[model samples]
Target: MLEKLIDDFKLQPPHAVLLALEPLRAISDYVAGIVGPAEALPRGDGHPVIVFPGLALSGAATADLRVRLQQLGYELYDWEQGVNNWPDADFDEWLQRLGAHLQRIHARHGRSVSLIGWSLGGIYARELAKKYPKLVRQVITLATPFTDTGDSTHAGWILTLLNGAAYAVDEALLKRLSVDPPVPSASIYSQTDGVVAWQGCQGKETRCHRNIEVNRVSHMGMVHHPDVLRVVADLLVEPC
Candidate 1:
């Protein structure tokens, strides 16, 4: 299953992928700009844009992102509790903690916030959006393996915990998070994403929700890729 995804990425022109996903990204960002708070939030913005780092990402990875967003003229909130590695964490407890933070950001910023979660953070962002839609203005998932009912692509550690949890991809959850004709979300992928299979990052529907593929960017670098940054800036700087 992953083989085709990878091959297609290698075969597909990244420029074409970016062209495909740009519309949806623009739409989501535009809506967020309209509904989201419009002040140049202080450092961390009080409403604080939340960012979730990718697998094995260090502070430096998101460091550039934070700085870039700031340079682009937007405030971002710190996860404070960084690098949410896929530990054997209690799902409910984790959500609670994250939810509490969202509440805190909302109380402080008094505006809808955007979630930029990389890979696993993308999944986390989706769950959080469902849990607190009122607080979330938009969602961006980077190279996240949103759908992969195959064990072939997972790392060894993952297989140990979800040896056969392929079916656990949860269509219900995907449906709930679908930002189609109405919802606002973006799933960014790269033809060279060394991590999760590119196919796994796509959205089957193109209307409201979309899967965007950028080129040359590695799964890790996608978090900071210039093209990715421009897309993000475009989304963040809109009217909302």
Candidate 2:
């Protein structure tokens, strides 16, 4: 059943209804943010943390979570790359820019940084870890699809639309992308995720990599869901 879902590029109409409820869930998370305190998780050790927003979203999408992490005493930074629209330009050039940005963050901190990415941003974070393991202390991914990339995701059509006809990811790259990062990493996913298939969000169980599951969290709400936030906090404070 999971394999069949991954082979299908589209989601059922029922899933659309779940996606529609995201705005309300987001509002509730916002309320939770206001009424709750940052001490829900232990304070960080002052390491710099950078957050990457999901596809078609700007850093603003992660503002709430970033603020929470900030209050938890970690130096927080945004991707600052504007919207994560899959552009029509040379993909390598885009990656080069991203790599340079990560390099700059490492240089400035004078210590390895931790990366937290939401959805497509998580893919980028994992790839960065693959390329720059020494610069990254750990990684956290929220509701990211890794198994089949586009096909396994309910947002596959959106990716096809934005990324165009050449949007296919070869099997080799997919295999490479799904591997555990050199540094400690966690993939946080929700069984009820309305966007990506749950199976694709999993990692090989190992001391260095694991999948953390949350309940009743919408795909879009993962960024600010209280339970997801707590899990991220726990992962962040783990010794690397």
Candidate 3:
């Protein structure tokens, strides 16, 4: 897999570089949207929490983050669908399945759930919020690419297929599914990401969202770095 990724990078460094810039621009725009009001952060009122993983990555790989959130009085839910495989159907289809899980959590706890998606998982969580607003109280995407998945390193096969299939960036679809500004979120990205360019991790315009740039962690390490854990804990903490 590593060799394939290197080959993919060599084959498409420009694409990789462009992909990197996309996130940086997005995150920059989002940060510019600051100086506004923030939505209520979900306290430990018993909403189940879900952590989605990056492309070719899963929640198990981010066990430390999950465990840390668990310590913060939040229940972490898994996809059961496995690491971000980039579903074959519309993102909404996956959202439907995810919505079911969110509903189940809400039923037991009587509060909306929060979504924390890493890399591709973060994109998944954002798409989920669009389709099922009532189901999600908030959204958090770590090093995720909302623009075009927006980085493609090891998922070359999937990317080729999506392009052949005329896969598009459904701006209308994403807009239709959009939630209120701020969404009480946090975006954490790194500069040393070897897989997806760090630029792709910087997010875009949104109210009440925090964009944090941490150095030295690789893409995978961001999934469990101690600072990453601290961000999660703080994001989940009740507002003062």
TM-score (all chains, Cα) for each model: 0.69, 0.87, 0.69
Kindly list the per-residue Cα lDDT of model 3 for residues 28-91, writing each as its tens digit: 4333323211433234544578888776656676676676566557887776666566776766
Kindly provide the TM-score of model 1 when superposed on the true structure, using C-alpha atoms: 0.69
- Deviation (Å) of 69 in candidate 2: 0.8
- Rank ordering of all candidates by lDDT, starting from the highest: 2, 1, 3
Give the C-alpha miss distance for residue 81 in model 2, angstroms: 0.8
Model 1 regions more than 4 Å off: 1-47, 150-183
Q: Looking at model 1, which ten-residue stretch has the lowest summed lDDT?
A: 37-46
Which ranges of candidate 3 are over 4 A from the true structure?
A: 1-46, 148-154, 157-182
By lDDT, the best candidate is 2
Assess the local accuracy of residue 207 in candidate 1 as a C-alpha lDDT between 0 and 100.
48
- In the order shown, the candidates' Cα RMSDs to the true structure are 9.5, 3.3, 10.5
Stretches of candidate 2 exceeding 4 Å from the true structure: 1-14, 37-39, 87-90, 163-167
TM-score of 2: 0.87
Report clashes for each candidate as comma-separated counts.
8, 0, 6
